[model samples]
Target: MAKYSRIIAQAGCHIHHAEPAQVYEAWTNPELMKTWMFLSGESRESEAKADVTEGGAWSVVNESQEETYRAYGEYLKIDPPERIEKTLVRKETGGQNEKIKVEINSILNGSQVIVTQDVVFLHHEQLHPKTVEEHLREQRRQTEKYWHEMFSLLSKQLTPS
Candidate 1:
């Protein structure tokens, strides 16, 4: 078998106060995205002109004080309140290259939600420094924290009147 460069990372959290379907809705809704998806200090927004269906295209922009990172991906699989799989592609100077597999899953407990992600980093050699294992590791940590914070914010914002 041809040895493919494999990079695996996982992150999970228990949202003890929210429903899995709520989480899923927030994830797929662009309006909800404007409220919680952006981190505390960053100004991020997403423009999703398509549905979250199989073969659908979506885009997200992560904006910081100095720069913005734009990303696009095609929904490969989507099961509401359960799982979402997509082929994530990052924008490069020349074209839309650098593809990776991103999977997001949700588990529920009463009113709680547990979200997990399994990402496979492919085409490692195309990176600037060849491999970004270390950067990716740090990104995983920061991203986990980011999502946790986002859910917290969502919980607060969505509380009943």
Candidate 2:
């Protein structure tokens, strides 16, 4: 068996204008996911595909001028309007894989979305001289940035037309 460490990273944002169900739908719905999940300037030429039920799989590919990035995952648990647990694999560069848990809660009649990711570095030799804690902090920082951007876009999607 391979040894694994639970290097956890967490981030959260409050969506004042949307309900928990709307936030949950945005995450589970592939079409909605495609609109907000990629980097700031990348084009969403390809749509995301997802099986939102428990044990189902999902994938999304994003293309940029410099490179293409792919992310795929299997749903581990799905608690409607409340929580979702999944395993995600980034199929580019380092190919990092992680277990992700998302919780959507109603706060002051609005939604607060929290994401927790547990990751393992299988090959220590590949990392630089930086300590594991340092690397984890950097990963957490990057993860926070991505989620913050996605949530910003999600907020826009929930805005009134």
lDDT by residue for model 1 (63-136), tens:
77767766667777787776666655554312333343323344354244444444333344556544566655
lDDT by residue for model 2 (18-129), tens: 8899998988899888887654576646468889989899887777777777778899999999999988887431555688899999998578999898866544554554
Q: What is the lDDT of residue 121 in candidate 2?
A: 51
- As a whole number from 0 to 100, the lDDT of residue 67 in candidate 1 is 70
TM-score of 1: 0.62
Cα RMSD of all models vs. native, in order, equals 5.4, 3.0
Q: How much lDDT does each candidate structure score?
A: 0.56, 0.78
lDDT of 2: 0.78
